[model samples]
Target: MSEWDAEFEVESESDEDPDFGPHGDARIDHAVASGTFTLDGQTFDVENNIWVVGDDAECVVIDAPHDVTEILEVIANRRVIAILCTHGHDDHVRYAPDLGLATDARVLLHPDDLPVWRLTHRAPPSGSLHDHQVIPIADVDLRVIHTPGHTPGSVCFYAEEFPGYPAGVVFTGDTLFEGGPGATGRSFSDHDQILESIRTKLLTLPDATVVKTGHGPDTTIGAERDNV
Candidate 1:
């Protein structure tokens, strides 16, 4: 694989090279949960991606999805720093509070999405997530970006300076996908705002940066740069 390893993740070092990137030992676990998503008086069946980032000792769970049990299984007794909410959409953060309570971790979300968030969840999030806020996992970082096109508080976490991905990786939530930007036809979403967010916030990243989405498959910045 090239220096910008976009696909398969290497667990250990090769004979040719011994050094892994910063916190190269870190692990990213993926799981999916199925449930109903409700927003703008519309409900649809959806499957949300549960991303566990960090090492065996401590990690951060991104997006609680439907089932807390599914997310906890991926967590597997690890110390969870926070249950990070990429957006306040029902499909993405449905069980955030449950997972946070289960793991004894804080549930964090961007305040701007509170209107949408309050529609489903009565209990508030543990705290607020601001733009450019840094979520530390081991030695790497999940840098927050306030990409508000998908929703008023939609954000993406850009993981970088870690092992394998010298070009870095991005947790797009619902802001971007393989074909183009995420849906904006719903309420509190604007086509022009989403286009601007994709153009300025996401498209500016490195070409090889992997795009991990809220749903569907993963793509890279380079592959999506021209399309967006």
Candidate 2:
């Protein structure tokens, strides 16, 4: 990948990567049950958010974020059945191996994002995911939507009725966000392709589908479509 394609050089990396860019609506709320944790940056400058699902019996973590110890401490109270990645960004999977070892949970991702993951961890995706594939992670039933844009294998996980909520929820890694979508400046990334993916794959979901973004606060498909 060229410098322009892989360069996500923000001035300073934080627990959260700044705030959501300009593509967000002021009215929609961005709150969800996903928890945040920290991690160490050995191979890369790992900095991102982590999300957790499930209640007392079992739970699944979305995005490793950074700081393995912190992530384990945060989810220490629950039984983690699996770990899922939206994409293979460094910050997203820095602690996945340790987390999976700690919980003995299966680590899963799209086959396409495996290369990106291997660049950091030296291994490919533990599992394979295809578009419209439904994966049951403990209590969470995730439908993998391969909306490649930010990366060739970029995907999002959607639950028709996310645990306690009546409306469906989508875990949009770096693909579809509140304000707009992820950057598609790489050789593998196509601007028109990502746009079309969002318009057709994501925007077609229910209006009330709650979106738990990879970086910033959560929003809904309806809001982004309307705001844009």
Supply candidate 2's per-residue lDDT for 19.
17
lDDT of 1 by residue, 1-228 (tens): 333121112311221112212343677799988999887677899888888988868888888988888888899988887888988888888888888788888787888998888987998788777777666676687788999888999999997676778899999999999898999898878788988998999989999999899998999999998777
Model 2 over residues 156-202: C-alpha lDDT tens digits? 88888654456788888888777888766654567888888899899
Write down the TM-score for model 1. Answer: 0.88
Q: For each candidate, what TM-score against the reference?
A: 0.88, 0.74
- Top candidate by lDDT: 1
- Judged by TM-score, which candidate is best? 1
Instruction: Tell how far residue 215 is off in model 1, in angstroms.
Output: 0.3
**Candidate 1 C-alpha error for residue 227, in Å:** 2.2
* Model 1 misplacement above 4 A: 1-24
- The Cα error of candidate 1 at residue 153, in Å, is 0.7
Clashing pairs in model 2?
23-179, 24-179, 38-66, 38-67, 39-66, 39-67, 40-67
CA lDDT of each candidate?
0.81, 0.66
